[model samples]
Target chain A: MRFAGRVAVSLYLLVVSLGLAVGQRSLEVCSGCEFTSLHAAVQQAAPGDRILVRGGVYREGRLLVDKPLSLLGENWPVLDGGGEVEILTITADDVQVRGFVFQNSGVSHIEDLAALKADNVSGCVVEGNRFSNNFFAIYLAGSEHCSVRNNEVTGAATSEAFSGNAIHLWNSSSIRVEGNHLSGHRDGIYLEFVQDSSVTDNISEDHLRYGLHFMFSSGNEFRRNTFQRSGAGVAVMYSKETVMVNNRFADNWGSAAYGLLLKEINDSTVADNTFFRNTVAIYSDGSNRIEVTGNEFLRNGHAVRLLATSMSMHFTHNTFTGNTFDVTTTTSRSYNDFAENYWDNYRGFDLDRDNIGDVPYRPVRLFSMTVENYPQTMILLRSPLEQFLDYAERLLPVFTPRAIEDDRPVIGKP
Target chain B: MNEAVKVMKYGFFDLLRSRWIFVYTVFFLLITGGLLTFGGDPNQAVLSALNLVLLVIPLVSLMLGLSYYYYTRDFVELILTQPVSRPAVFLGHYAGIALPLALSFLIGTGLPFAVYRAGNETDAPVVFSLLLAGLLVNLVFSALAFWIGLANEERVRALVIALGVWLGLTMVYDGLLMGFIVLMQSYPIERSLIALSLLNPIDLSRIVVLLQLDIAALLGYTGAVFQRFIGTAWGVAMSLSSLVVWIVLPLLLALRTFRRKDF
Candidate 1:
């Protein structure tokens, strides 16, 4: 009697497995097919099914996926929002959306309309998509372990009021955003309340506000990203343990612009970055324990504007060349440390042949202070009087922050 | 105009043969050529050239104009006995010295760029501005020197005053402006700063170069005020017209002094 019962249970398990394998079907959505629209195909597809969408425009208002499925596009099928609603929203787990062109989502201030939005979903993958003129390109909210990669998104943003970000993440964790080209938006990439996420190999340029913005986001890593010519450049605020490595910030020139603005940030690592021709390379206000190492600051107006409120900031192994002012501070006293840096204006010699200068190199100039307090004095840049004041101040330590000197300055590029 | 041209030709030829003018030309050549080769960047060469134009050109032009007056006094008195009008001799002598100096500057700086093919479309505007600044500075300082020579009877005194003028403009004026801005830090002094920069020809030339080299830097803080005024075409026209006025006022003053003075 026990052997017969075991055989019946095994047969029942095999029949159920066979039923699942046979029930999952691949559906095609095209002009000639019965499933003419993407919404119709998604509506009819069961859980764990695959839907292949061909190259045709589907003017669907909003296609919501409540079950796990893979929506694959052959030759980039168009998902048009008809300038009225959000195009695609995923509410289920383990859903994949790939190779679709999302276009012209409505610009409504009341609704957070997005070309593609993944909400309350886990293990969601959005890849190889192109988004243009959307209110928000790809938005992930309350999602975890999702990846948005290999996407090109551009917006027709003229101002910050009406435009949205290219890729925005809110309350998401462990999300991987990689290989995305984002431009002409309010913010290229924005993160709020996001943790343990990685943003890598992205080019963010010409945005209305910031190339990349971090608000209340902690434990995020941004690597190998190029942020250039944006309104105020990349701003990392109210975040901790954020690692920004090997990034390039260039040509963010304006009255209030900075290459990287770090406000109220703590315990962050900004390493191996290149800041070129920015009005102000790194502006740190109320930030602490920031380790800025192995960075190249070239021809910037002010290489680092370290405010008095920032503390315990370490600057080492950095190269500062051709900058108007290597360091400028708001207060005459410095709490940050600068050591073993290479300065183009260093006139000290290494008499001991140790590849380190015997004398300290003072990066701050007296004219820089005067110009900081009284910006109108900027007209005196490179003048003989300014040079004389700097020379005199170097001889007699006064006015400038005397503690902001690189005692072990590298003799050459390090 | 013909008489002025004749007198100008004589002076121009005389200066071209002088060892001092040759040294000046060679000095510029060495500076530009050395910077181009050693600095390995044309933009850097232009910046160094800007400093040379600002510091050296005004002083050299002043000394040349004043000393020429003192050394050539007998010749001037002899020329006065001729049928030439005073304005002709004065304008001719001014152009004569100014042209050779301008040419020397142009050749010394421009030859390296032409040889290197370094003046791309981006660099062309900066180069043109540098040359213009040099020429205007030369003319303005030379006119002031001539006026000083005509006003002061003693050569040593005239030379001393000319040096004082250079010192005052290049060094002391900026120092005072710095002090003033610091004192008036509470108020909005951006427009006043621009007006003050226009008051000094050296500062004006410096602004022209600053607009190019440190423009990224200048677009921030008080520098933004300068960029807004100096970066626009209208601002450019205003500064340029102001520079032209600098040349005209000094030359007009010197010409008036030359016309009424009894040799």
Candidate 2:
């Protein structure tokens, strides 16, 4: 019995010693340590170790991350690009880089180098970094399951010809973009051939061009985002199965500015979005099988403009209050359905008190028709004669698009 | 005539007597001259100089004008007790300030032009335009200071009102115009740009100078739209008219208010 007890004690001590050895394998890289530079520490670190880069200006070259390690930048260490190529390049999976400043990237129309570039990598996290004065801030291509959050990207865009996008994603899937502030670029975020992405809680403002642009991408969701004072708030083209919800589009006012522009999009849902003070709320061209419901259009120049090629878009349960023109359609036979929308200018009565209009509410004003023809007849808007003519058209329902009528108009503002 | 000459003379002497004015003038000349000499492109240099002058000249002029008005408030009161008309006294004081400021700006900006003329002849006209811009800015600020002085009795209130007017003219007016544009997006009020230009003094000034440069194309469709609606000559006339009104109307209102007030 004594010999058996001694053998158990020896085995327990050996196991405890092995556990401590495994715990000490993950090294710490502090600022005041022997390894001064981040690159140096990264080079010395093995896989699954932590490289803690403390705060200072690391005037370093492009840092290539080839190991599956955690590289954390404490206190926002600045990594100047030195007017060259990318600042950080990731080639490994499960890498995490946080809290760094990337600046002064070189301009090349052909190369398209970003401050942070990740290619063919997966399960990476990039958060809390400042990207300024660069051509492109973050560029992820052919990557999967990566998360980018809480980053600020600002560019001093002189002209459209020489500017680059703040964030560019190409052929990436299952990516998450959250809580970023992007401004002053050609486009705040650009996605091409990307799929199954989620972009939420982001503010993209004052861009030289579109705030958010995605082309040939599908199965994406954009929620709780704010696009303000941009040339165009958002543009989705040649994509399908997308959802845009609870976004605010404001102050995007120019001759060609729009809150949202959809081209060749099919089977998308744009609901619960608020568009205020944009030149046009939604400009749809060649888009079909889309549902626009429970949205608010306030103080927009034109709430909805459907071109000749657009078809089969359903508009229901939306509020059109204080819009200059509720709807504008080019074709004679509009295939779209407008049902159960509250039009502030609707004059039809519901005698049964069911809140549904007895007569169908024709939302397309005669002024919009005239503007479509003349384009400068917009100067006559708000004039006393124009108001009189609008009232007459509402009473008569002539010269407006016949199919573009809201069947059930709600009495109260939605 | 003698009394008018005497007032002008005293105004000149009053500005020259302040040691801070000399230091500021010398510093302005040195800094502007250094920047122009070290600048890379002549066009960029002129633009930078114009921007600096637009931002700094008005501020300096306002400070100088306020100090002069406050220091001479008692003298102005005593002068009001005398036989001279208030408008004439005001005009004489303005002429005194304007002459010295124009001289300083020309001299400070001219030396660089003379040096740059060895390689570039067009620098002369550009420098001249920038100097004129500086003078106009000074006039606007000085007139504003005079109006503030006449409008308010307390020195602190007068200074605060002057600063507030300056901030409104430069910074807050653009923000308010943008807000107005956003609120009225549905209305086809592009024609309202004409009336809007008439309200802001800085926009009027920008239109005048930008039209003179004939680079209105750089401002894109908005500039072309503005040019088509209001011709170059009409824009300049409107700007001059606005400047005259900015000077005269404020003084008139202040004069009436001063006459009716207890002070």
Q: Evaluated with DockQ, which candidate comes out highest?
A: 1
**Which stretch of 10 consecutive residues in model 2 chain A shows the poorest summed lDDT?**
A376-385
After TM-score superposition, the amount by which residue B256's alpha carbon in candidate 1 deviates from its true location, in angstroms, is 1.9
The list of candidate 2 runs beyond 4 A from truth reads A1-31, B1-263
Docking class of 1: acceptable
> lDDT score, residue B20, model 1?
88
Give one digit per residue, the lDDT tens place, for model 1 in A92-119.
9999999999999988899889999999
DockQ of each: 0.47, 0.02
For candidate 1, the lDDT comes to 0.88
Model 2's lDDT to the true fold? Answer: 0.76
User: Which residue pairs in candidate 2 have backbone atoms (N, alpha carbon, C) closer than 3 angstroms, thus clashing?
Assistant: none
Question: Candidate 1's error at B32, in angstroms?
Answer: 2.6
What lDDT is reached at residue A89 by model 1? 91
* Model 2 per-residue lDDT tens digits across residues B20-49: 667767876786667767654454456556
